[model samples]
Target chain A: MTDTLTCANLSKSYGGVVAVRDVGFTIAPGEAYGLLGPNGAGKTTTISMLVGLLKPDTGTVVVGGADLSADPMAAKAKIGYVPQEIALYPDLTGRENLRFFCRLFGLPRKAVRARVEEVLDLVGLADRADAKLDTYSGGMKRRINIGAALLHRPELLILDEPTVGVDPQSRKSILDGLERLVADGMALLYTSHYMEEVERVCDRIAIVDHGSIVAEGTRHELVALVGGADRIELTLDGDVDTALAKLRGLGGVTEAVRTAAGSVRLIAEGGRYLLPSVISTVDGIAAVTAVEVVEPDLEATFLHLTGNTLRD
Target chain B: MRPHPVLALVAANLRRHSRDRVGLFFIVVMPFVSIIFVGMALGGGAAAARLPVGVVAQESDPVAAAVLAELRAHPDLEIKTVGGEEELRAGVRGGALAAGVVIPPGSTRFELVMTQSSGSGMAARSAVDASVGRVAGVIEATRAATSAGASPAHAAELVRRAQAASADVEVVGSDTASATPRGFAYTAPANLLLFTFINSMAVAAALVESRRIGMLPRAFTAPVRRGAVLFGEALSRFLVAAAQAVLIMVVSSLLFGVSWGEPFGVAAVVGVFALVATGAAILMGSLVRSSAQPSAIGPPLGIVLGMLGGCLWPAEAAGPTLDTIGHLFPHAWGMDALLTLSRPGTGLGDVLLEVAVLGLMAAVLLSLSLVLFSRRTRTL
Candidate 1:
């Protein structure tokens, strides 16, 4: 059996506010899954429950096929968590910090020494492992934070906002590290609000919103759910509904949304094949000034499903 | 068993603690140095005190000069000359002379008169009394032996028999008196107090730092139980605190020559006090977030507790009110136990109440801290 993590009907609410409601998903072994969402979505809440950092108000969390809440130690043994906040001890040297976590996972002394060296190399902190974290730059601290979790080499790794608030170079390095972890046959449940990150790294993506998974599947599969491979956006001079109505009448136009500023955006299946048709079809509207045909992006898929920008 | 995750944390914490030179200095060195400094400040030996005194001689007898010379030889007494009885009385009242010695005219006797309630006055008058009493007895024995028809050598022998008495002091208290600690004996108890307090601050900082760094959160995510974390933390703190207590006992006795009374009893008291401080650090760490909060809060609290519990000074000097108030601090109970243990000649049984109370307090505080700490980790 694949060592996968599953959350079954996990629901949590604070008073009258539901944070994660009836959320269910599973990450296959060695499969890198992204829990993508906008701000205020249930991504973090679900990650919190899945990692056993929180007990869901209703339902159960299972890691590596073992119930998390049922036998936490057993469930936790198979999982490593890299929290959103940088969690490395600032007072300790990188080597010392890794050794500290290695013991926490019960690795033998010899194994601990080996693992510390390995993790330091993995995180690109091998040369700087002797330096105290307070002396490290923000990027170095983030890498050390990730290294602490990687020391034990658990079956599953959970990273909450894995690349939050880092320089672009560090963020790329972190993503590269995550990809390598997956290649090393480690399953990952990565949560982030960054659309490009999810698209670039995850094999499967689940869009979470308002405490539920509104849409989820592989990137191509999910974009295919919208039934159109391309989305065309038209900026209308003053009146957008007139142009949107004309665009909707054209063949290959699957859906059309008119934004508040008179920009009409059309999500169409087989967008590339229908781009010329869309341009010629909307040419009669005369209100259309600019047209752009975009490929199936997480942003468009997200907007198609949630009616809001991925950032929003 | 997967080598208890908390034990690993304990080792790391201890390592970090040792790395903190400033904290280690405060924990291990400050108490040791404070003992030496405070001992020097208090007078390291049972040397006599110099008291300001007034002497009123109504008669210009040459015997009075002889008495003054005898008084000068006693290391503890410093006698001063006064103009008249009125001047002596005024000097004593105005706080210049601790007491006044009046030698009445047409009489062979002398009188000691001053506020007996003052420590300085008591010390002064006691010194004067011993010297005068020695001189008077010898003279009286001489007259009596001569009257009884003894030879000059025989009279001197009688005087020797009469005058050979050990020096003694009669002390009394008043408002403006400088309080003497039941003297030289406050060292052992005070050292116990100071060591416990400094170690507690260091432990508190360690605990808070662990929480802030997310080490505690990471530990909880592993196969480690929260109880293990709490116990591990306590163990680390106790290790440091126990070492601190041993240093205090050794230093106090070696340098101050402070008799720590029953050796085993002193060890037991120190051990229990360390536990109490460990629990307090855990509690403070759980109740706050970040190292700054604990570092900021621990030392000040330790200092306040030290003062209230009579670590820097004796709780005895604080009297009934402050003494009762001092019991609110765990250090007070520990100090009281130490004081009983070091009271020149006190057995373990003599401090049972204090020991039991301190033990109970340590148990309760440790339980509360464990409960709080476990709650914090249980979330993750």
Candidate 2:
């Protein structure tokens, strides 16, 4: 099957400074591929090049088998791009905004209204479709922005930081909606600095830093690359040295370090299987007040590869 | 098939503007309101001031009586037939009459007595001359006919027949020597050019807003050509300015008794000026980076240009040097065309120069705006 999007050695520079360089990736049909990066990590620039907003200095971008450089209109027609900014008419109603984009994309006149309704319903904005966008909440506006991109049902949807500045409830709703789209076989290229959000929605991820992709793989593959490690934190009422020493001796435990405030942090493989052993080891030496497990995630992968947090 | 991209842009602009209530009020309502205020202020003085003139005939001659009758027929003139030249001169000197005409007994010779200190006094003198001149021409025609071997009574009959054979003539408000356009006639066109151009600059704000909201760049991602977006913006401004001009034209005429001289001439002038305004709006849109800048700067810039172009008052009121400078702007040419159209006997052909100037302004400004706007679009 043809990849929905392919960026081979895509590089762009403004003046002497390279904004994005040798950025290469492919997204398959029905795959949710996350582009993980921090601010100014060239994720937006790469997305801009992918969306045909900026011409890359080198390499190629192919959208659904159409080359963006040679046939931009055809390529653009195959991909739906939702910008990081809310790109919509504030004065127009939600319905009006959808109808405008539908017509602009050259949808059939008779099909536009039905499609507008469908997208509005999909975004859970059918009831407020007639309301002006300025009256919408920030989350609602973002939903409409995404809905506009979906009107043509382009094979690929590239959303740049879609959940930025959204309330937690709204963020959950957006992530859930996106997951539904992916389940329906729509390919997604979700770019974000929020690793947790990406971890929740994306099936695979490519970590980008300083104008280059540092690492890329499935969630499992990437976690394994980062030593397939899980972190365990144990809060105790007494000293954690006995527990820390015991954790160090346990099989699959790489290291045990005592942190501030009578707590012990253990880096281990197969954290779920090691949980019982951890509980038994700490039973006598300290009263385990609290325990938490952090599985290997994109954040860990990013930090493991780049020696910095995704937020940094 | 889908509509042309530029037309779609224009339609979108129109739809968006229709929802902008405050913008609609300033563009469509304010110009006529300004005309009404001007009319109210000027109506009292101009409507009440009639030129009083004395007419004295020393003998009971048919020709002299005819002259007095003609002067009495003039709408702007109030005639007092005094008994003697002395009384007529005294009325003129005392300001009781603006001017007096003395017919020398039974002769065709007539003397006009008035100081040409003001335009109205000169207008009175001209009116009296025209009235008496008609009578003198008839007498001269009679004398010529008599010399050509016709009887005196028969000569007089020949002159009357000739007078009856002349074509019909229309007398307009500006036909008199005092060719001042009063009240709404002057204010309506001035404010129409001023406010329509001023309000149409709001198109710049709309353009900047589109850029701010990221709508403009989003449009470029579509299949439409870039020219479509630029033309769409220009068309929106032209339509708005044209609509405002038409509204002011129709409303001022219907509400006030302001006469806009020729329909075709008026339309040509307004259409050309609207194009010029559209060009200005597009240029402003291209130059400004922030949305609020256009809204803040457009009106003041338009007003300054309008003032320089004589939209506030007559270009004539500005000294000759300033009037020369005023013509450098499109507003001056537009105002000049409107002023010419408001005059008696003016036609489309009479204001060709003004039309040509406005057209040239539109062409130059629109070309420059296109260049700048396209460049700006590319960078975005």
DockQ of each: 0.42, 0.29
TM-score of every model? 0.78, 0.74
* Candidate 2 steric clashes: 0
Local distance difference test values of all predictions, in order:
0.76, 0.81
Ten residues in a row with the worst lDDT in model 2 chain A? A303-312
Docking class of 2: acceptable
In the range B252-334, model 2's lDDT, one tens digit per residue, is 77877667888999888889889988888888888898877877887898889888887765555566898888888888888
**Regions of candidate 1 where Cα sits further than 4 Å from its true position:** A14-17, A229-235, A238-258, A261-264, A268-293, A306-312, B46-188
Q: Pick the candidate with the highest TM-score.
A: 1
DockQ value for model 1: 0.42
lDDT of 1 at A306: 74
